[model samples]
Target: MRRGMRPLLALAVTLGASTVAHAHSVHAGLSADGRLVVSAAPAAGLTRFDPHARSPPHRLPSAGGTESTVSVLIDHAAMESGLAPSLLRAVVQQESAFNPAAVSRAGAAGLMQLMPGTARRFGVHDRFDPAQNLRGGAAYLAWLLRHFNHDTDLALAAYNAGEGSVHRHGNQIPPFAETQAYVRSVRRYEAQWIRKLRAE
Candidate 1:
């Protein structure tokens, strides 16, 4: 498939109404605070990765400056990583809103809000560099997808809350408010991007 069409194709595969419904049913029930209600506290010994919990969430930036350039980079990374461009866009939006200079309070940086360890693990030398950051983030997401057997919700949960947190919670989304909201927001953005791509 053409690079441009990959998002559309993934839309068909990943963005069905059933996905959202099932996610709500399986990963999170309807909590008044939108937190994941669990029968027990999350297991111990997992390093919780919740950057957004420390940093105030950023609104999507107005499109200008690096916007077009970031789109190109996202497409290139998506192509090389075999990830959906819509999903990449959604992650970038949720992470840094396309700001390559963005850094979270917890020390995550760049468009993907990669931590120092994650950047190094993904061979991302310059996390402030848009291309490298997107590449690293996409590669990590792809690996998470495989690690979680292509379960998008689990992969997304791992993205926000760490793989160990998911495993600690018995291969489920960790019972964290921020992580649950992060997964929900990213999925919402992915769906919006898919709809826009289909319209275009």
Candidate 2:
């Protein structure tokens, strides 16, 4: 395997999948051969591998208290899902404060606070798993960005209040106080991330 295949292969191994295929580099299932194969972005020069079997239950990795490891995973998810690194960082910060096991009162779970339905839509079998959750959330965010024409505010509003709610309100941010606050918070965090990057 080429060095370019290392990232995908590592991801597959992390998920305990012998052969993993993702339409959008989010989750993994299995394949026929025992060797791990991953389908990543074509730009990465990774070959496509279709999995023939179901993946086993994932063994959850420790996200650790310092949050350093989670940050790396966030960067990876952002790259794979075509999301801005700052935006993903902000979303994760606002969503779960880097806590992989975090669960919301509204039933959102993991580092990105993914709802059950959203998680399933992104092929995330374990919501509390940081890697899976970040990838799933990043994929959803990327789709939202495209759906709303790369309007960060609108996409974030849709993330908080659902795309239907945004559409129902004429593609604008909804009037709900909580949703508004959520968008504001994410934006604030995003700004901070941007400043941090600039300073670096």
Candidate 3:
């Protein structure tokens, strides 16, 4: 078996046993196995796999403990877009830890940790601008969702590593420990979000 198949196989094996719960008021459901399983409700929006799953879920520190400008920006954007404040918070936290002024060794910057080229493409003049940075990051995520056909895991893997890396590996999660862990972390959070949505 190819090494890339390991994670998928593992996921399949674990799918039937996992259970998630969360506290929130939303309309959605998650399967016992952890795949995004939604109930038949009109209010529940579309659910599908994304092809260009590239970004990973960022882990942020707790609020009121060590707040940062990037965290505030992400929270504001999530609120404005109605895309789950916690999800955005988690993404940014994992990406840059709410560092509005963070610059990755690879040149990713700002709250969402936008790459220099990505920032320019998104028309963001200043990655430090909280609003602009969040908007660009969110926009990039939306693009990735479309690219990956809504497969959250794939999209996240691509985000952490790069779309090229995912493609080079035959559309599988790349062989990077950080990227792999990032996907799992985001999926766990997403599961929680879905659970909360369903409980409501």
Candidate 4:
């Protein structure tokens, strides 16, 4: 408010220790090799935002980094399993937001969120290994697609909530809210990935 106090206030703002600043930066997106990458300085702080943007902005960065290595792996795995890479990316996005080490409270681990049993079932010895994880996830997704007669929605639901849930629901999408939301989110992300591919 006064001339003498201005320098301290300016320093506080510059150091991001003021009421309106953050001290760290968040870096996320894809690697040059097409592998998704995300890291935040442990000190990174959150900021308030405008809730009424015309288009809801991304809470976190997305795939523009285009990790080529990940892309290559997904392409090979998806093709071998007869699934689309774009769709696979969508699933990965939903499962872990591309965080290969991400683990859920339910004990699902890795980018595809493979539960311990599921990882073992798929012969994935290391769920944190992106290649192995994607391979297992892609294989399971292909199986689910086939089991559900190629119904994308049903297959996605099965991935999110388990095939048993889909079966209990008469092979339709399970009626659980989380499952439904997961399916929708995957589809939305899948479409975006598809568009990105086309643009490229």
Candidate 5:
């Protein structure tokens, strides 16, 4: 097995046993100050209940220059989903270049560059809504992660090109130039974000 597969397999094992504590830069949950907050659940198990009700919540930073509203939502969703925020940011950067108002030639919209059909399937009525759009996009990513057995590269490729294309090619990374480039870019960004997070 490849090196990447090892980590993914470990993650699968951990996930199978129970949800692991995800290292998140931003903490989500209820605020002690009586403000609304989104918190992460315990690392040991998956709970359908909202984790935001916990305590000692941190405020989410506002979107800044070059940071679209969708990116913020994606960040929050990643934290809430127990996924890596950097990974979400990297995917968003590759998908829409952090443009919340971006529209693909193929009719994908919002920060994550979700297609109309996909957005609908994810129950996103307003693709322009940052929170809804991020939730939809992150949910889709989570689905892809599970589908690809946590293979980040393949999952990302599928996210860009479509699962059908990947499956048609024997579950291998499709040879499409755009898809390949997208994966590489996302990986690069993921690495960068991971470094940034470690630095903090």
Candidate 6:
């Protein structure tokens, strides 16, 4: 584990996947019902094809309050990786707003916007798989947080602009506007989720 090491490359992959749910038009959640449910981005989240392998039931976590079928999966993934569920939710919000089928213009895929190389490094063969995507993203985030001494800001900055940029700027958040905004946005989401958890 390289602490505070600069990341020169985006965790990227070149494989093409469905930008939105394309297998079938239904809620492909972690349930035995096999009912496809899109929470926020319906058109962008619903699947046209059936995603087999029923998702694990939504288990309520200690902090995130009552979890939805969709949310429970993310919360569990974060918790399994020794992370705060709220923080990971914030990242998912920023990355793809929990859209497992999302694909960024930069080729970042799945819910976490994982780049091709990064996806492979994280063992995410199917970026569109929500479970796999969330697991991989949480793993990467945990690694980054450790590398940055638990400095959420620095870790997020590195996550957005690559750790290399942080190192180049003397182990601080880079000056890139996109990276700066991204860090701020993620933190804001983090705070929001934290508050939500407390209220719950």
Range of the 10 consecutive residues with the lowest summed lDDT in candidate 3? 17-26
Better of 3 and 4 by TM-score: 4
Could you estimate the TM-score for every candidate? 0.69, 0.68, 0.58, 0.67, 0.65, 0.70
- State the lDDT of candidate 1 residue by residue for 43-149, as single tens digits: 33211122123444353233223345357668889999999989989999988876655678888987898999999999998675667888999999999999999
Taking all chains together, the TM-score of candidate 5 against the true structure is 0.65
Better of 2 and 3 by TM-score: 2
RMSD of each: 18.0, 10.8, 18.1, 13.6, 14.1, 11.4
Off by over 4 Å in 2: 1-65
> What tens digits encode model 6's per-residue C-alpha lDDT throughout 15-85?
12242334443322222343323332334423222232233222212222212324756766888888898
CA lDDT of every candidate: 0.70, 0.70, 0.57, 0.66, 0.63, 0.64
lDDT score, candidate 3: 0.57
Model 2: lDDT of residue 161: 90
Shift in Å, residue 114, candidate 5: 0.8
Q: What lDDT tens digits, residue by residue, belong to model 5 across residues 7-76? A: 2232223222222233222222223443333334443222122111222212223223234323445556
lDDT score of model 2? Answer: 0.70
Q: Tell me how far the alpha carbon of residue 87 in candidate 1 is from the true structure, in angstroms, after superposition.
A: 0.6
Off by over 4 Å in 6: 1-67
Backbone clashes in model 5:
7
> Lowest-lDDT window of 10 residues in candidate 4?
48-57
lDDT of 4 by residue, 55-155 (tens): 21122232222234256666777888999889998998778766554677677776688887888888897675667788899989999999999999999
Model 3, residue 76: what's the lDDT?
59
